[model samples]
Target: MTEIKFYRVNDAYGYLSNFAPYPFEINGLIWSTSEHYFQAQKFLDKAIQEKIRRLKSPMDAALEGRNRENPLRSDWEVVKDDIMRLAVFEKFCQNPAIRRELLATGHATLIEHTKNDNYWADNGDGTGKNMLGIILMETRKRLKAE
Candidate 1:
């Protein structure tokens, strides 16, 4: 049951853009669990595990091409989106206007999100002081307040 549920969640995340391992939520005491985080981790684990499994087979390359083209797969999609987002930001960083606009707007993501790197670094660190999407949302809030 776990595996089946994991696959469904993984496929959806893989197919959808702006998808992550989790989204934010508030609950009792101003803290709580979210469905996005649960679903994202489930697939992230499977993608890593499956990559290991494929490495054991010499014909994995031939199989990989076909697997990526199939809509049933999310592994390629996730990788593609990350690469594409970084690529766009890298190009944008080269533009003076975009960089100036980003900084002037005071979007907290103006630094990290606009960077070509550090966008996808994940760690098993114990510190969980903040949620992933907090910065951009907060930026929006500040803009509205102004």
Candidate 2:
């Protein structure tokens, strides 16, 4: 099977990355990127969510989301994947250019190539779950059917 590895937002397949500057609206608010949406959802506090939303960059939003000082929602673990799926789906749907880009991939396997995150990436060794890639593929299928 063909595999498309993506990570940096500046790379060829960068649009697939959550950090890509794809502003999408969800829950009546516009998110700068899917990463901001995904990370902000980790908290139930509206203040925290707003804080993440206003951050200058997705990396900053991610950093704030990981700060244990602000307690995560009790059901974060159970709902995170679904949240990610929603964010990614909305991202492509709201951005026509990237939606076409995603649809252009055909059936090639999408891989989040990164060693920093094992669960969301390929762990740079093909061992991680690559949940982000899986979610992207699922989103692509859904988009194609639409």
Q: Count clashing residue pairs per candidate.
A: 3, 0
Give the whole-model CA lDDT for all candidates, comma-separated: 0.30, 0.96
* The candidate that achieves the highest lDDT relative to the unseen native structure: 2
| Root-mean-square deviation of every model | 17.6, 0.6
Q: Give, for candidate 2, the lowest lDDT window spanning 10 residues.
A: 19-28
TM-score of structure candidate 1: 0.24
Q: Which regions of candidate 2 fall more than 4 Å away from where they truly are?
A: none
Off by over 4 Å in 1: 1-74, 108-146
lDDT of 1 by residue, 1-146 (tens): 11100112245222111221222222211101122222222233556324423342323422443353333435654554443333233322334443354345443421122122233211223122222223323433443464
Ten residues in a row with the worst lDDT in model 1? Answer: 1-10
Count backbone overlaps in model 2.
Answer: 0
Per-residue lDDT tens digits for candidate 2, residues 62-129, read 99999999989999989999999999999999999999999999999999998888999999999999
Model 1 pairs in collision:
21-40, 22-36, 22-37
Best by TM-score: 2
Q: Can you give the lDDT of residue 3 in candidate 1?
A: 12
Residue 75 lDDT (model 1): 65
Global local distance difference test of model 1: 0.30
TM-score of each: 0.24, 0.99
Model 2, residue 96: C-alpha shift (Å) = 0.5
